[model samples]
Target chain A: MNAMPAREQETHILLVEDDPADARLIEIYLEESGFGDWAIDRVQSIHEALDQLAEQDYAIVLLDLTLPDGTGPENIRRIKAEFPDQNVVVLTGFDERVFGLEAVQLGAQDFLVKGDYDENSLAKTLRFSIERQNFIRRLEETQKIARIGSWEFHPDSGRLILSDQVLYLTKPDDNEVKDDVPSAELNQLLRRIHKIALSGREINLDTRIKISGHGERYFHVQCRMTRTSTNQEIVQGILQDVTDRYQTEEMRKARDLARKSTEIREQFIASISHEMRTPMNAIMGLSNVILTGDGVQGEQKQMVQAIRDASDILLGIVNDILDFSAIQAGKIQFREEPFSLRSVCRNLEQILGTKVKDKDLGWKMHIEDQVPDQLIGDKLRMSQILFNLLGNAIKFTEKGQVGLYIELKDRNAEKVELRFRIEDTGIGIPEESQQSIFEDFNRVKYQHKTYEGTGLGLAITRQLVELQQGQIWLESHVGVGTTFYVDLGFAVEPKLTNGHVVNDVLKSSEGAFRGTILVVEDHKMNQLVARKTLERQWPEVQILMAENGQIGLDMLERHHVDLVLMDLQMPVMDGYQATSLIRRHHQARIRQLPVLAMTANAYVSQDPQLHEKGFTDFVLKPFEPEHLFARILQYAPLKAIRL
Target chain B: MSTINTQIDLEYLDSMSGGDTEMRNTLLHMLAEELPKEKDVLAEAAERGDLPAIFQASHSLKSTLAYTGNTEAIRLNEGIEASSRHGLWTAEDQEQLKVLFERMDFLLVALRDLTSE
Candidate 1:
């Protein structure tokens, strides 16, 4: 009452009492208590009290335990059942003081004994009850908005208390049995709480609970142990519903796992494909050496031709798998260099012309006058794209013609876009299967026969085209032909050079120049192949042999070596380490030695740092004999050609 | 009925009435009339398996018994009320209710003798 302030508006009180004397007494008490501005509405029963409550808002309701219509705690229960938010204080008879306390337990804010209280005490109880009820209401509202609840457990009393919001959040399904005992999930939670209490440590845990309407919900529970002022141990905690965020995180984790597995699979395939190449190099190189050597008879030469052809097909398939996996792993790097566009076309023609003539199919290539002869682009990839399309056309066609047409599509000062059309009169693709033809392992079935090639040819070609910022599409009609159109952009080379520069160098370095070439190779077959290929070309050139880079370095110290064919990926000092040693040698001649790296790894060959790593140049293994000889001719020193 | 065997404390009633003799006498008469009726209601509710009614009767009887300072009866009534509210009517609860009825009968008889005196 001392803390009570005078209200600007009248405070409304609804009194439900059956005894007229008790009602009169309470009215007098309020009047004496200086509640002049309070409006007191008196009713004879619980029903009348409820009706009055519905019609107007009241600051508080003073209920009687024994009413004519309702008695004991039932009167308080009835009023509360109607208006759960209504503040209620019960007035009990003198002997029923315990009933007053029971009334408070049954949702009444406070209780009073009829004969025991003075005006001031009565006023104080009513005012304090209203304030306490409001505070509880606000606390419940805040908890509801945050989707969070609070709980407390006393270890000594074995008592667990949950706030109203906690009760609502953890409500069980209607069909579930209701009992005073804790539920299984609640028991698990209690165990966690007990552990925290015993260890005197704070804990954060994620728990799953089955709720009334929601199937199962995730909750983030945070708990800590603390002692009251009296040193009573208690565990207090908050539970926040985090189902939405948890599910999203789980989905993201699943997606990431799927992507990681794909990467691992691709890496495995790439390594396997790479392993296949070393043996492939031996097969192809040994077969080439056999075909080029002098043979006894016609059947022997024909048998060697079959072996060479089969090896070529197997090598093609292996290369296709390697390239496809590399592209999938995002490891393909395109080189921007200046090269003659016409030269790329000439090479493609020379490579495929014999097959076309043997099949009785006509071959033609037309370059528009406006198309630049020299351009800056990945000349190797551009040649590969054209070769794949033209090769497919020639393989599929039994007769008729295969043609390549190149024309300038668009031009700016910096770059020019060239459109290429490779057309062939072959067994054309069906319209329905055209779109998926470029997908991996999609082979065209024609005349009850699958083509004898890896299905990755077109797929690799399409990926290479897109990687170069180019587009490729095809048009076909069954039994007529297939024509693939490609649009590729390249920066035009600014400098004009004599087109015969390479030929001029070749002419100057004609005939077998005398030089001591050291071949550092681990494989005996590969070393023999290199010796035979080099010795067959330059009969006067002295060739030294070493099993590894360490042996090769030792040989270089003893002899005046003109060149080193450093084979990468060897035991006891690889090509890279050997080249680094030679480049860093004390003698100027050894440091400036022309070290050409030989590798079976296409990835290593494509590395832009190959020359920067002290090697003068690199040659891909299963080497094209002419290309190997040309690279050697450029780097190997001429031993003062005998006049 | 012997008042010594009733085991009822009058101190709570005295304190509640604040030394008002008339108020104390009126409360004793009210308990004498209401105790028997509440015990009957509790037994009937249990017989019919009406848990809500049983809870109400047990709850009211517990409060009424508190005035006599009968701790045993109050505790038994509280247990019965709590179990019934959860829709549980176990054999122990039935036994407790029976004991509560006996205590109420003794309390009612003692209240009647006091009122007459």
Candidate 2:
């Protein structure tokens, strides 16, 4: 009676009974039992009961043990399965008291025996059933929303009392559940609880369990020892599923490891390449100095030329590795400046013409008349793309003609796309291998013939082309020929100017160039190479030397130098710190002085903040004599030549 | 394992209705009218080998048999209900159902005589 709804508000009841006479007897009992205020609706079978339940709310459903559609405890299960929140009081006969208890275990709130209970007992049962069912439903909803379950363990009995939520969370098969806990996961949990009870200590931990249908899941468990009102020691705890958050943390850790390994690899390659370049600079620079000097005739000159050629190939391999690393690190930069297409072609012809002639192969250079002479783009990268393609064409061809054909593909007021075709009658590439040709370190072997070069040429070429928003592809026949086509767009320089064309003038002004240059370098051979190379190019110029940046700074203080050729990676002070000092010098003249960085570190060349670091420009080491001279002539204030 | 010494016991109804003989007669008449029809259902379901229907019919009869204090019929019907629930109607279960039907038929005749009195 205490749990019953107030008389002012009518409680609706649904009676599912197949017998009309039995239903009417229950109605008369409800009225006699002081529940006349309640509205009772009757349905004959489980099917009709479900329809009525769906259409309305009921305070309680008095279900007969056997209906036409379903019978026994299964009727209660079917109804509760669909409407878990519904309060059902199983109505059984006097002889079926055992089944009435079974129905309660199967999720019925309570049960009644007909003709055995008085009106007062019937009223009390229905009222208490509704109240108990509501409490169970609230607990279920709370557990589902928070993904948490609670449990109590008794150490003496080795017994566990798990809430309905805990049973759902463990999801044990009917056979796997023993002593009210799942076998595998429960054994582990019981061990922990036993430890907690023995030590009388609270424990917080994470544990992993392999559920039957669900894969491995992680749980956050917190438990402690406590005593009941009866002084019985027990362990109580809560378990929360943290699988999603734990898996995310694991993925983040894996990604960080991958990124860290890539960084270490790039650093290793860079240091190795830097160490190799210093010695190589001495080899290439000193060799050029030897070849350019006035010396003995025929055989001696050719041997020195061979040494120069071998060193050139070695240096090319080193540069290719460094370029590939730079591309992998996403550090390659393109410069937009005014450069003549004609000059780039002329240089290519001069470099490749000798190799073509040596093979007794015909060479052809044709330019479409409509193609512009001047264009604005990254002049260095453009030249590298053309050089890589032409070099490969010459290397693959045996005796056939190597040709470069250029034409204007499309033009606008601001930009023009130029198409370059480098064709060779060589051992052509097969169609099957063409798609993967542009992948890194891929080299094609035709008839078991191996070429002597790093396999990064075409890969670097494609990267450079794509970086500049251009397209490159090829057409080839296995025995007939191979022709590579490149289509690149560039901003047109409306008027030809005096930008990179000054390089031609610098070539002619060789001995006419004069300046007092300071070379700050740590390596003895590199210092000797730099001094001799500078002196050979400009016989009248004076060259000063320093082993480190500190000495270089002192040299700048004592001498009136035109330019400082600073080498990075020195003993006392590096080039970056030395340049900072020079830029911030006490004297206005030193602060205004130009410093050209000569570095073996390829990363320094791609640094966007190079100028901000107080160096005017940088030249990569194993320096080409012509490129070194060009940088020198550009920055050094020569007293003799104004231009 | 209580034996059925009498065909009917009004002690349960007497306690519920406070010894009202009129109400007891009305309930007995209702049981007499419903028990025969339910017994027919159980027999037809057994003839057709329908286990679910047999379970339902026997389950329904056990309650009405409790009002008559027929412990033997109740026990037999419970056995039939259990076998049908397991989806099996073995030879023993069929013999039990036969005994249960005979007991119900005798109970129905006894209820008719009582209602007439």
Candidate 3:
């Protein structure tokens, strides 16, 4: 035989008795029993007993029939009332056996009359009562943990029998459950249960009830008609609380609905932008070709220039709406690269200088001595901010000077902050509308109504500045001047790198390219624009045209092509598949051919790794003459190579 | 005249057994076997003049009749159970109980006959 492992079994007892002798005798008997270890606490009054029980846990209470503060079977009732799960046994006098029996009916586990039993019997009675009470406690715990209760209904007798756990769940503090529930709701529920029972089907339902003190609660109830052993019809049911799970499912549904609506809005913006820009591409591309034509250098030149300028303004307005929608949808991501601050300033000057000169407005730019020539930041976004602000400065100013000042604010080994101040002696903004000017579509109310704008410029500028972790604000009066101050941060690149190449292509009049150019485009107007632009670039260059990528491939087999200007989104074969086939050609010379992607969708060119798609470079639609020429010159050089 | 003047409906039992005649007969035979034992318990409690015990026994028997659609017996047992609960067993309660016992005898004979068929 193996010895069993000894387990620590300690029972705590509370003896509530006013008589000191009886208390001592009870304690001695408990210690002498030798059944288990005991830690007995004695209290003389019911008040003292309750105080001790409140602070500590006891297995059972041996409550005397008489105490200093209370008497009779009432002590057992009181103990049970305070701690409903407490096990209590009444210790009565020998003549009070009738009272002990009454206390047992009330809810006590057992009763023992003093002097009527030996220590062994007394120990046995106490041990049995504790064990029985432990079983009841465990059953109640299981019921509460599962949040479930059982019920039975007899339709013919109109009698309802509820378990103790059901009474605790529905009636709570009250013992009677039948009257606590609302009569109307209970009648409705029973009607449904009866219908289901009569149809020989089990009843399963989700119901909401209002408990007087507990507010609203949800329950999932299931019941079926069952035959008793004596062949009686009874409906037995199990009800469980399902409030938490139901609410969580509802919240998840709401979140998915919100996410779906946002996706639809983004799709609408993308398609609308594409539809509006396709025609504008043809309008601007053809006008640029006509302006660089060799004949009719008089009023025809001015008319073509006006058409080009109008197309430019229309494209700007369309982009404003597209950009605003993208920003609202949180779709813009910034890029990190080393760019020349001087080059950015020079691009802005070239872009806005002609308009200012035509308006006869004085424009000056000043850079502080400590400002770095090349710093690491998002250059495209930075240039957009300057273009919008400078355009506004030239538009609002009549005759006075518009000045741009740049200064370095702070510097560490890691990063530097630069502050830009663009002051214009324009029709200054009024104090009342200055804050409102930054809101979308809010144009300043001025006496001169000739100024035309989409009024989204300042709003987009503020979002762009904040995206770069910068702040922008303006200070102005009604008539004096308006000065916009912007603070932006940039990481200092120690090793100097050449910034974005300042395109001096407009100054180069060398029509210098000698190669066969293949233009693959599906749209006829786009083909005409590309052919005319390439013909003007190199007067002596031979250009071949294809309606799609298949034709382009067939043309490539027959003709020795030097460069392929590919258009994405075609009829039979799209640019991606065509580029993949071209790169996988058997001959190395054809596989290495430079393919430039031309797209009306400006968003495509934003990706820096367009070269990975077999594209040597990318150009936006509505191509500027100089930008198109500059790209061609880079890939297909002049006949007289500058070695 | 027949001693068993009443007929009990066994539609609930038939449907519960999915119209299987053999299963229904088995259920009817079980009911026939159990009713005599429940009747003895009711009669013993009535003889002892324990109204509470009489009430409990009748309460259980009332539901048994309700399932088999023994409507008259259900009415009689309900009266006895209610009177006993109020501690007032009048002549009306005794009369209903006598009729209820007779109905129980009829139910047992009826169920036995169905099983035999």
Candidate 4:
């Protein structure tokens, strides 16, 4: 058959056939097809073909299904099971076309029937088998690199066949499931799929399996079943290790849980604040009434003063706890508005006057010349921070002094960073505990525990300062004293002519407000307090009361009220909705009329868009009479009795 | 425990009231009028497992009793307040409320008598 030679080339071919005539025909066909340089190896039986295949590398094996020693696809399966990438073209009779096609499905590259094609077709099938085998080999090489593997199970033989990659994956475990049989667990899993396959359904499963003597690992497997020509069932599928992806999913779930709990905590704290302040409004409000009531002179007046003091102490504790919780839950909102730094500090000085006197400590507040007249910032929060630091300074100082020094640290045309230094000659924190002093519920142990506080003041102060894009730190000695340094930034605002200082604003109300005022409140005691406090300031000023926003709206329509004091969290339409409605009123003057929102919630001031929420300004409950009066006078300037 | 000190602490009241007898009487009247309603709210909240309500009532009573130096009532209210703060209103909290109610009842009677005098 070697009729021609293509100079210097060698192509080996193995012809596995039992019949002499068939082999000779194949050889003649290949030679006629111009495969002249091919060195063909002829074997009569499957055993001899295997021996020859093991001995040399043949480019293609022309496999005949019928053999003297072996019969059907077993021959093809045995060779492929050993050398999975080996190329084989099945040779069969016309009557055995089905078996030949089955052999191809079992990993043979292509199939051909005797007398079905010419020499050209024979040569084309052979060349195509080699090319297809090379493509499969390269694909398997890539899959192996990506840690993916393939597998097959023959139910008739109860044999599990694994790819090279599958073998490599199990290599780490050194696990051998006894003579190529799957473990009981794996067999049970296969049986389940076998049941599904009975109905011709496919199975896809992602599960974590623990191999004997090996740790747990996750796998994603997709599989289906098919039957051979002999009706023998075979299961084939792919398995991928997905342990890393599984772990990532678990971590993501954990993060979501943490975020959900944080939100719940924030909501809990907000509700608690509301609950606590509602009653505080009653206690403080009634006590103020009793303090101002007639027929209470001498000892009775002193008793009312005591009640007021105790109420103040209780209020302070509640405020501290709420502030700390709010800060911890990241719920503190900050507002930016035009406020004078000088006025804020001076107001703080006056508010802390009684504590300074009670502690018998001298107090000094110094404002640098370079400090801006007005800055756009959360005035209430800025004042709160100063108030907390100064309050603490006063509380700890016994006889020496507490001082606050404010100066411009750095400034630009757009913003200014001011440094607030509050120093006190009082019991100081130790060197080691200084760093952790700002932690929640942490307090330096005093010898006698004489000081009264919730120990949350400093922690809340630090959080508020940080929320404002500022920083706070402290230095202290055990016995000598303590000094806290805070740096905060504020946007510069155009200075208003004759900027109002605390003294001038509080003390210089242009006589009693003589215009009509509307008081919208839900609580009876608070309404009484507002009425009495307003009357105490201006006895002739006409007053109107509304229990809620709905009533408030009705009152505004009927009365010539100059100002509306709106409460935020009231029954049957709250202050926010009422204020919005009022702003949208059909009457231009009524819509433009100022609404001063009065909220028991201190957090209201933290809302950056308070003005947008339809409020001229807001005053917190348990209001200082002077502060409330000033806020009122700002809206309803004093006038001759209503025309 | 036998003689439960239910009387108002004169020293705390003296300091708080600046020794104003009429102010002390006014405070006593307020306490007498409010304490029963506050106690009933706490009891009902505990029975209904309304922890926020229990927490609110306990806090209100605790702040009010702090003015009178009713140590037992204040301590029990603090316990209830703390328990309910975490939304855990249990049988033990109800028992503590009972004890608080007893002590507050005794003090309320004393205050009423003082007001009449």
Alpha-carbon interface RMSD of model 3?
42.8
Model 2: share of true interface contacts reproduced: 0.00
Q: Going through the candidates in order, what is chain B's TM-score? A: 0.89, 0.88, 0.84, 0.85
How close to the true structure is residue A239 of candidate 1, measured as C-alpha lDDT?
82
DockQ list for all candidates: 0.00, 0.00, 0.00, 0.08
Q: For residues A351-371, could you state the per-residue lDDT of candidate 3 as single tens digits?
A: 677788999989899989899
Question: TM-score for all predictions?
Answer: 0.66, 0.64, 0.57, 0.66
**lDDT on C-alpha atoms for all candidate structures:** 0.76, 0.76, 0.73, 0.73
Interface RMSD after interface superposition, model 1 = 54.5
lDDT, candidate 4, A419-488, per-residue tens: 9999999988779888888888777777767467777888888998998889999989988999999999
Model 4 chain A: which ten-residue window has the lowest total lDDT?
A496-505
DockQ winner, 2 or 4? 4
For model 2, name the residue pairs that clash: none
Task: Going through the candidates in order, state the TM-score of chain A alone for each one.
Answer: 0.75, 0.74, 0.65, 0.72
What are the per-residue Cα lDDT tens digits for candidate 2 across A1-643?
0123435578778889888788888777788999657877888889988888888789999999888898889888788767766899999988888889888866688898888877788888988987787777787679778878887777877767666556666774423222334547756775866686569778788888777877778888888888989898888888887878789988898888878887877876786676556545655675677677764347766665776688789878987998898899887888766766776676667666667888889889998999987788877798889999999888888987999999999998999999999999999999998998899989898999877778899999999999999999999999888999999999985542211122322322232556678899765545656877888877887889997899999999999888789987565687889988988889977886778888877677566556556777677777777667666665555453444
Candidate 3 chain A has its poorest 10 consecutive residues by lDDT at: A497-506
Displacement of the residue A145 alpha carbon in candidate 1, Å? 5.3
Identify the superior model by lDDT, candidate 2 or candidate 3: 2
Worst 10 residues of 1 chain A by lDDT: A496-505
Clashing pairs in 4: A299-B20, A299-B21, A300-B20, A300-B21, A300-B22, A300-B23, A302-B17, A303-B17, A306-B16, A306-B17
Model 1 per-residue lDDT tens digits across residues B1-117: 123444667754543333335646766776676677778988898899889888767755654565566777776887787698789888998898888888777777777777888
